[model samples]
Target: MNRKLLVLPAVMGLAAPVLAGCGDSNAGSGGGDSIVIGTTDHIAVSKELPSPVDPATSYDGGTYTFFNNTFQMLLGYERSATIPSPDAAKSCEFSDTKSETYRCTLRDGLTFSNGHALTSEDVKFSIDRVIKIKSDYGPVSLLSNIQSVEAPDDKTVVFHLKASDATFPYKLATPAAAIVDSEVYPADKPLDGLQMVGSGPYKLDSWDGDKAVLSANPNYKGLVGKLNNSKVEVRFFETAADMEKALADGGIDMVNRTFTSDQIAGIQQGKEPNIKLTEASSPSVRYMFFNVDDPTVKDKAVREAIARLVDRDALTRDVTHRTATPLFGAVPTGIVGHSNAYFNTYGQPSRDKAAGALSAAGISTPVKLTFSYPTDRPATPNKEEAVALQKQLNGSGLFDVTLKGMPWKKFLPGAVKGQWAMYDLSWLPDFPDPDTYIAPFFAEGFLNLNYPGGDIKNSLLPSTRQTADRGQTDKDFLQMQDILARDLPVIPLYQDKQYVTTRDNITGAEWLLNSSSTAQFWELGRGVAG
Candidate 1:
């Protein structure tokens, strides 16, 4: 699976589809009133209805909210490099050492809110639906390796993978693997309403176009410990500033997702006794991927030249403001099997060396190129960062750079289709593993949207995946890095940091910033005023 991005589709003017086959329940002691949680997202929860609901498509924050309320995955992650935990399934394991076949035992009393027993048929149906409906709505490659899902009984589910993969269990833990009801969902087309049918701790209570109401599920069999609260209301807004204002006015209980480092710092430094901020390491890495299809970028010498020209230090310090660290390799730290492969081979960008490479290629004319990025997602400083990136390349004199941009909803699909010569991009880890970083873009796998020739297109990456040995995978990855360093198709930029703000009245909030960036809604409660 490709690393997750910020996924600012709502701000980018793309209307995400509403989620179906999920529900919520009531449990909080806070009466019938709801606590609003604000976010700068312009999502349309549902169409042909006046109430706001969960969007079927994956947008960063909404995914967590939707899953907490109505959906369930077989497994889940609480931190980086951690094993998947049983969610809907009572226990899960691979049947053999080959890691090709996985089996899960559902909890004995698992049932949808409607009282229908959750079965292997629903698991088979949900897994198959994602593959068949493959829409731009979300990344489908999350389930690309599965040959088929089999269920021999009502409580047992089995998955047969196309090849030997140790990480198959982690894939099943993601929201893309969310289990759905076979009865209410249509097999032919995507569902188009706000209603959901799920078996989670919380269920949907009400909707108001841009706001959602949630309550605890009384039938949930997976209650870990005593939950902190019973009700949560999530609100969507048009900008971060608006969300911040709502927080200041006590219009919301918490602020989640996509706050910059400085914004996070501000909350930490504030004198407001009621406000609290939480910080944690995110497994995600942000970097630029090159359009290797372009004639200029396709050249190994030019690609390496561009890599040598970029000032990753400046980009991280001035643009990102130390919120993120410079990425010396494709895979970031925390992800297993990651190394500083690129830095070990290429060292750092060098003007003289870059100039020499250009001369050795017999190129006297300045190379002309353009870079694109999303406008609405990261706010204004990112624009400055793009300009800095542009200046660095253009200053090399061997290159003439033009800067271009659009909203993320538009930019993402275009970048995926190899439509731009060069652009700034970021990848959030779909799962916390080195494989999450390397395989999707370089391994010639399903999400390698631009890489043709299957795995053979890049000679080195294929060698790594072809082997079943972990040591061999590491060796093959090292060789692949060498090839990429020499070719410089994409420059390793920075691994981003995730920040969250909370009121002092909030407890158990640290669990929210995990590898999946998901929090158990039941774990939250009011803390003493700071």
Candidate 2:
């Protein structure tokens, strides 16, 4: 299929809003039986399970796993596809040329897990509630262009938009746009705890401590039809070491996320006979954000000098074990409109060039800066990467760096408040769009926290969002990348490659790595252990 079919066109010069899985089967005793999967604690679930499991309220990986299985959306992404096909809706398309009106026809006789009748009213209610509630961490921003939703009939649903947005249909495929039964969930507030009533492939059976038990929903009638396994238990671990040990000990059938570089190296070395590992291209990225409010980073020369002096190739080779791709811009490759703007502007690392940049800004040598990163995050070697950055900069004899490490819980508050002069963080794209990369970081006082003044906040972002044509939008994205490279508000470090490990008996494990960078638990099944 043409990937360009996923790209939506703009109306009124507004290109539209850009925001920003499966498994297998069987043999043997474990074959076609319940499969237990283990994951790191990075999958964010509330202490109180099932109730807060409300799709409108949760936005983390763990919650998404539940939403992906339990709730059905109007549309969903097919494995590895940029465009969205139908899930709950039989068909969906824009009804008007301005892209201001969208219509979807729900599948007939659809019902929730509880046997509640599913209709267009449920679809309208789900989206309207999300916009009305507008939770701080929730994905309300994804639907900011939504004007209203009308359930014209039991099967037909119409959406009115404030502006022409080609990306609107894609938003329906996200976790935030999950359909809910109005009878079970309050329209005003999020469903408290794990009290969920969904109409997807799986239903929450029970939760025991760190594990969630799920069973295939008989009432589920969606695009992803049938299940290889009727039951699945997801186990959460505090660290990759523990998860890896469990996989080795046969305590779990599969493991995903939070694997250290050394752990991956061990897996690749064929140290574990029963375990099989695979890697997929991921859109995840790590970068350093400068608090422009700080006196040291306020100077453009200091930021540029730091960017030039740091060696990305060495960092990826030594620190990440080539597990991550060296990134040159905010928008990673694979996505449309991606550009190596930083590489084109900064070129290769050279101390002389860095020195010249600093000298040109009338700054003396031996500049001192404090870098902070979370020590507790096992997902990436932030601390080790920080050490490498310090060594590289200090080795230049032009910088004196002091590194500070804190747990993520404590570090996040300080980082968001702009308390740190410079800090490191990673972004997993909320949506697969160039706008997701540009808007969040450059929009003044957003995730970048520090204000990125000038064209980025004013003309560039507005113009980029307004251009509806993919070609024009791509051009705007290139301009945005160039602006990011020139401004140096944040330095792109690397893009992560997703690694997942499963037992030899597990079939279809490779297909579970969907385009959204989440696992499709439904696709996993057991076979005779080889």
Candidate 1 similarity to native, TM-score: 0.84
Those runs of model 2 whose alpha carbons end farther than 4 Å from true positions after fitting are 1-31, 42-52, 364-368, 413-420, 443-448, 452-472, 528-530
Residue 485 in candidate 1 has what lDDT?
62
Question: What TM-score would candidate 2 get against the native?
Answer: 0.86
lDDT of 2: 0.74
Residues 286-405 of candidate 2 have per-residue lDDT tens digits of: 888898879878998999998898788998899989888799988877776778898899899989999999999899989999999988777578889999999999999999999999
Off by over 4 Å in 1: 1-35, 45-65, 78-81, 193-195, 268-273, 378-381, 444-449, 452-479, 528-530
RMSD of each: 7.1, 5.6
Q: Model 1: per-residue lDDT, tens digit, 1-530?
A: 11121221111111111112122222333233444566654445333222222223452444545664577777654333255667677677777666677888876667876677788888888888877876544546667778998999988899998876666666777767877778877654456656777777677777666887777766665523344567787787777767776777788877765555556556767834577666566666667777776775766778777777777788878877787888877766654345676777667888888888888988765887787877877432557778998888888778888888787666766765677777766566655445666666665342323545333244554343334333335555555555556556667888776665666656656654445555556655665111
